[model samples]
Target: MTIVVAVDESSHASRVVEEANALANAFDDSLHVVYVLSRSDFVDMEETNVSETGDAMDLDRVREIAASVAEDAITDANATAESVGLVGDASSEVTRYADDIGARYIVVGGRKRSPVGKAVFGSVTQSILLNSRQPVVAIRKD
Candidate 1:
C-alpha cells in the first residue's frame, strides 16, 4: 500500500508529511509526495519569470521547481519518500495521482477558510476531500 501526500513549497507541508508518515509506518506503506503547479502558479510564473542568465524560465524549470518542492517538503519526514511533480489543477492532479498509485490514503494540508471565502476563491483541499477515491487525511495548518 502507498500513502499519497499532496504538498507545495508553501503551506504546512512538513506537518502534513509528518502525519502521513505516521500513518505509513502504521500501515507499512511507502510514501509518495506530490507537488502540483496550479493555473495560478503558471500565471505567476509567466508574469515574473527570469533565469540567472536573464533568459525567461522555461516549462522545464517550472517542472524542476515542482519536483524540488515535493522533495524538499518531505525532508523532515522520518521515512524516505518518492517525489513527483505535475502541472495542472491541484485538486484533480492530486486525486489522479493518488488513484494512479493505488494509494490507501491521501493526505493534504488544509488551510482554514470561511465558507464565503471558499465559495469565492475555491479551495483545493476541499475539492480533494470531496473527489478523491482514497481515504483522505486532512492536516490543518497551525
Candidate 2:
C-alpha cells in the first residue's frame, strides 16, 4: 500500500504528515509526499510590478522553499517514498498524484473552524472524498 500526503508549510501539515506516517508504518506501506504550488504562486512578481528590469524570476527561491517543505515532511515521517512539487489546484493535483501513485490512502490538512469564509466546509471535504476512490483522511488543526 502507498499512502499519499498533501502537505504545505502550515503547522497543521505536520500533524497530517505524522498521522499519515503512522498509518503507513502500521500497514508497512510506502509514503509519498506531495506539495502543490499553485500556478499563480509561480508567476514572476516583478513582471506584474512593471517597474523592475533585468530581474530574473526567483524560481530558485521557490524551489528551495518547496524542497524544504517536502524534506521536512518526509524527514518527520521517517519513511522512504517519492516527493513531488506539482503546479495546480491543491485538490486537483493531489487527487491526480494519488491516482498516479496508486495510493491506497490520502491525507490532507485543513483549517479548523475559522471566521467568515475562511473555514473549510464539509462540502469541500466531501467533494474530495467523492472524487477519490482511495480513502481520504482530513486532518484539522486544534
Candidate 3:
C-alpha cells in the first residue's frame, strides 16, 4: 500500500515526514511526500511582495527535507519514496492524491484545534480528516 504525507514549509513538516516514513517502512509501502503551494496563502503575498514571493515559490527546500527524512528512516531497502509538488487547496489536493493513488493513509501535521471547539481541528487538518476516503494519520506539532 501507499502512504501519502502532505507538508508545508514549516518545522513540523520534517517531523510529519519522519513519522510517515516510519509508517511506510514498517508496512513496506511506498511513500509520496507532497508539498502544496497554497494559492490562498501566496497569491496575496505574491501581490504585496513579489520579490520575496518568487523565492517562496521554489518548493525544493520542503521537498529535500522529506527526501532526507525518507532516506534516513528507511528500514526496507526496497521501499521507495518520492516528493510531489502541488498547487491548490491543501486539503483537497492531498485527499484527492490519496484517493487517486489508493493510499493506505493520508498523513498530516496537526496545527491546532479551531477556536470554535476544542475537539474541532484547524481548517486544513479538519478538512482532510472529514473528506478523505482513506484513513488519516496526523502528527501533532510541538
Candidate 4:
C-alpha cells in the first residue's frame, strides 16, 4: 500500500511532504501525493478573474488553472512521489482517495488555530483527522 500525502497551497505543505516521504521510506511504501481543488477554489478563481479581467472564467479555463496550481504545489512539495491533481471537496476527496487506494497512512498539514477560529473557519485538517479511517499523521506548521 502507499503512503498518501494530502497536499495544498498552504505554507506547511512542504513539511507534510517531508514527513510523508520519510514515512514512505521507513515503511518501504510508495509515496502518493494529491491536491484537491474544491468548489470553493473555483468560486474564488471565478471572482478573481471577473475582478481582474472584467469577465468570469469558463469551466475549461478554471480547470486548467486548478490543475496548474495543483502541479505547482506538488512541485513545491519537492518529493519524487506519484502525484495527482483532482477536483472535488478537499477533505472528503483526500480521505476517499486514500481509502480507495488502501493507503498505509495518510499525511496532512495542520495549522495552529484557536478553538474559536477552528469553530468558525472549519478546518480541512480537522475534517480529515476526524473522518479518515486510516492512520493519519498531521504535521504542524513550524
Most accurate candidate by lDDT: 1
Q: Candidate 2: which stretches are off by over 4 Å?
A: 45-65, 76-81, 114-127
What lDDT does the true structure give each of the candidates?
Answer: 0.86, 0.73, 0.73, 0.82
Candidate 2 residue lDDT tens string, 30-132? 8888887767776645365444656665765555556567778777766565676766677787898889879999987776444445444443344566798
* Model 4 lDDT tens row, 1-142: 7988888877777778888988998988988778888888778888988999999788766656655654565567676787666677889988998999999899998889999999999998899999999989999888
Best by TM-score: 1
Counting only residues 3 or more apart in sequence or on different chains, how many pairs clash (N, Cα, C under 3 Å) in candidate 2?
Answer: 0
Quote each prediction's TM-score.
Answer: 0.85, 0.74, 0.70, 0.80
Report model 4's TM-score to 2 decimal places: 0.80
After TM-score superposition, what is the CA distance of residue 34 in candidate 1 from its true location, in Å?
A: 0.7
Q: What's the count of clashing pairs in each model shown?
A: 0, 0, 0, 0
Question: Model 1, 1-142: lDDT tens per residue?
Answer: 9999999777478888889889999999999889999878876786775533556767877878788888888886655888888889999999998888799999999888999999999998999999999889999888
Find the 10 residues in a row with the least total lDDT in model 1. 46-55
lDDT for residue 10 in candidate 4, whole number 0-100: 72
Off by over 4 Å in 4: 43-70
